[model samples]
Target: MSRTKLHLLVPLAALGALVFASLSYAQATVGTFYQQETFTGIESEFVCQPSPIGVVTNTVTESGHFVITDQGVHIRGTAIQDYRIDFADGTYLLSVSPSHFERTATSSVEVFTEAQQDRGTLYSADGQVIGIVSVFTLTHITWRDSNGNGVPDPGEFTSEVSQFRVTCP
Candidate 1:
């Protein structure tokens, strides 16, 4: 090859290597969002009985969607809801407010490996336990030997799981 061509190829090769390195680094550091909360339409309005002449509170429920995204993990479609409670009484009780909520949802994802027996739990941004994703239907398994030594490196193994679906109750 000509010197001019060699010089040009060197820079191009370096650029390609740089790009690949950046992409790999980004993928490695990319973390998953355990829980996503989206607001849906309005919910039904309710009236409180006994009008808590001293302290009255009302509870309301609304529905929304929660999406979980992770690099190698598979998650299914799931929905969540936001609940609010208003107190009509003069007393301002923090406990009366609807600050805590819980829901159980089922999600199915194809496990990439039979070795992986358990599905990890998903957490909300606020560190709340949201749902559990199970790999009941394994579709494929991929193995990578990063060192090119024909042997799997410790902590260097990864797999891809797909066909994830979710159910919320």
Candidate 2:
């Protein structure tokens, strides 16, 4: 090979290796995932009374189709709330809100790794806090089976946390 051609080939080979290495090491988690909140008990001033049984609980469910990018994990999705309200009267309301929330994913740490942990804030369609107030940790990349139970539970995945609320209810 000519000297000039050899020099050019060497540089090209090095550049190719660099590109391949970077791509191989890139941390990219792009897929659809759900985020949810389980019935973590209720907080209200007015004690509800039911003739049969009084129950207070809330479930906040949200999901995202996220792409891990250099900027951040960009996600666009919605949240729907299914709740039951027990009135001070014997009347009980089993309601799925007429409204669902749409939100853009916000970030504290955009980078993703296996078992990466993060605590970040989320905003609803109307700019209300919908995620956990204290902290929301992705304990693992996805679902984790704890308590040695083969069946997956509600709080077993990244979707559900303890303190999540759709609004102050």
RMSD of 1: 20.8
TM for candidate 2 is 0.35
Q: What is the C-alpha lDDT of each candidate?
A: 0.28, 0.36
Per-residue CA lDDT of model 2 for 54-158, tens digit only, reads 345556565545444333334444444455544344344343421222222222221112111112232343545444312121212344455546446777555
Name the best candidate (by TM-score): 2
Task: Report backbone clashes per prediction.
Answer: 1, 2
